[model samples]
Target: MTALGFLYPGHSAEDDYPRIEQLLGSDIRLPLVHTDIGEDAHRVDALLEMGSAARLAAGVEELRLSGAEAVVWACTSGSFVYGWQGAHDQVRSLARTAGLPASSTSFAFAHAARELGVRRVAIGATYPDDVAALFAAFLKDAGVEVVAVRGSGIITAAEVATWDEEQVLALARAADHPEAEAVLLPDTALHTASHIQALEAALGKPVLTANQVTVWEALRLADRRVNAPRLGTLFTKEPLVQVH
Candidate 1:
């Protein structure tokens, strides 16, 4: 089995890992490590504060014990709030500390967008508008264009974790623009693993959510391909020439 490690922030959306493993099937093992950040880590500043290299390095150490070939920082805003160049430094620091290949959900979304042959996208952000803008900037740095955006003003991941399929789909639809090739949902806290195909179907276009891209990026860094069609176009599509 291909073993991948994910370092998620806090206790929110703890079910997403098992859901992703179920979606990706039993051929892979997704060992996870949580940073022990409390529920108060809902705001961008608090999330970033909890996402120090020291915290992630500790989680990576635990994940290494489970034989993880690669590690992914699974928090979107936690990395992107620092901007593109800063996020790169954070991943480099994580790679050094973990002694394995490393990447973040921020970079994962950008890389996944490029891999899907999408230049312009709409954003379904669960964060406040300012935090959502940072994600748009992160994608811009990666050479992707944000044609439209909609924020839910959700202040807490605990709240986002409680969202059902209908809520997620509504955000995705609201984010979709005529100019957008895909809808990008940029919140790892939101439960997106089980609703990706449904979102794609509803929008009649590609939909890339946080946890989905995080897992895809992890597999890519580990050089493993799942080819699962249920996970949306990111999994089933052939690669474009290296855009990263």
Candidate 2:
């Protein structure tokens, strides 16, 4: 079994990992270690602390013992709030500490978009407008265009985790732009594993959600892929080769 370790920040949607594990297959395992969420607010200062090296480092031992081959910082806001370079440094530190490949949800979204050859995407965010803008900036640095960004103004991961199927679909529909090749929901705290296919069917385009990309990112770190059509378009197709 290929084990992917996830250093999730707090308790919002950590459950998404297990659901994705079941969807991926019996041969794949997702072991999640919840890092300390100093403050669950989606604010900048709080997120920086939430994704700090110290908090992330605390989980490495647990994941190492879980037989994880690669580790991911599974919180989107926590990582993106650090910007592109900062997030990279965060992952690098985590990898060095864990002695495994490391990545974060922010990069996962960027890589997922690149893998799908999607240059333009619309964001359906659960964060405030300012926080969502930071995510847009991070994506822009990664060479992805944010056609539009719609924020829910939700302040905390706890609030985002309470979102249901209807809320998820509504956010996707509201955030989608005719010019966008894909729609992205950039919040790992939101429960979306069960609604990926439904969101795609509603938008008639590829829908990339946080938890979905987080799992895909983990598999990529392990140089592995699995057939999981139910996980949405990201899983149904082969990764596109991007020529830099």
Candidate 3:
């Protein structure tokens, strides 16, 4: 099996990889490692402020040393906080450091949107409105049109993780816009991957959660294709041609 490495902040293994395995159907190997980003309460803001190409390069090096075939920075906020150029530079630096392919959750969303030929999108954020606005700007830079955005004004990463499925579904439903061809839930800590199919069903549109896009981007970089119906629209839909 091909190996893919993920660099995350402060979540446990139990929280993420099981869903990835279920989505990929035992065809791929995922090796994940966590870097200390303070604590869950402060990590999102801290990573947003401190995430740099240098820091990501270091993390990728660590994952490479551990035998990761490709490295993925799994935090959506961290990559977008740097803006479009910064996110690109960070991914390039990670690839350079690991001598392998690299990507981030932020870029994953952009690639997914482009692949689907979606110009209009609705954003569902677990961050403050201001932070969500920043994410929207980043998406706009990537050529996606942001038709609508709704922020849950969540303050901390841990709080985001604790959000129940029903609450997430409700927030997504509220955030969905009729003009949007896709709805993006853009926080890796929010556990949106598992609920994507249900959300897509409810909204009758494509739902691209952070983790789902992140994994999809990583797999694309490695030239791997996956068809995971349980993971939702992106996977169920046909594979998109690589951008650039």
Best by lDDT: 2
lDDT of 1 by residue, 87-123 (tens): 9999999999999999999999999988988999999
Task: Give the range of the ten consecutive residues with the poorest summed lDDT in model 3.
Answer: 36-45
Q: What TM-score does model 3 achieve against the real structure? A: 0.92
- Model 2: CA > 4 A from native: 242-244
The alpha-carbon deviation from the true structure for residue 134 of candidate 1, after best TM-score superposition, in angstroms, is 0.5
TM-score of each: 0.96, 0.98, 0.92
- Please give the lDDT score for candidate 3: 0.80
Candidate 1 error regions (>4 Å)? 38-42
lDDT string for model 3 (27-145, tens) is: 68777777666544423467654466555655666677667778888888888887899888878877787788888889899999988878999998988888889899999999899
Q: lDDT scores for all predictions? A: 0.88, 0.93, 0.80
Error of 1 at 99 (Å): 0.1
Tell me, what's the RMSD of every candidate?
1.3, 1.2, 2.1
Q: For candidate 3, what is the total of clashing residue pairs?
A: 0
Q: Which one wins on TM-score? A: 2
Could you tell which candidate, 1 or 2, scores higher by TM-score? 2
Clashes per prediction? 0, 0, 0
Instruction: Encode model 2's per-residue lDDT on 29-100: one tens digit a residue.
Output: 999998999878989999999999999999999999999999999989989999899999989999999999
Q: List the candidate 3 regions with Cα displacement exceeding 4 Å.
A: 12-14, 39-45
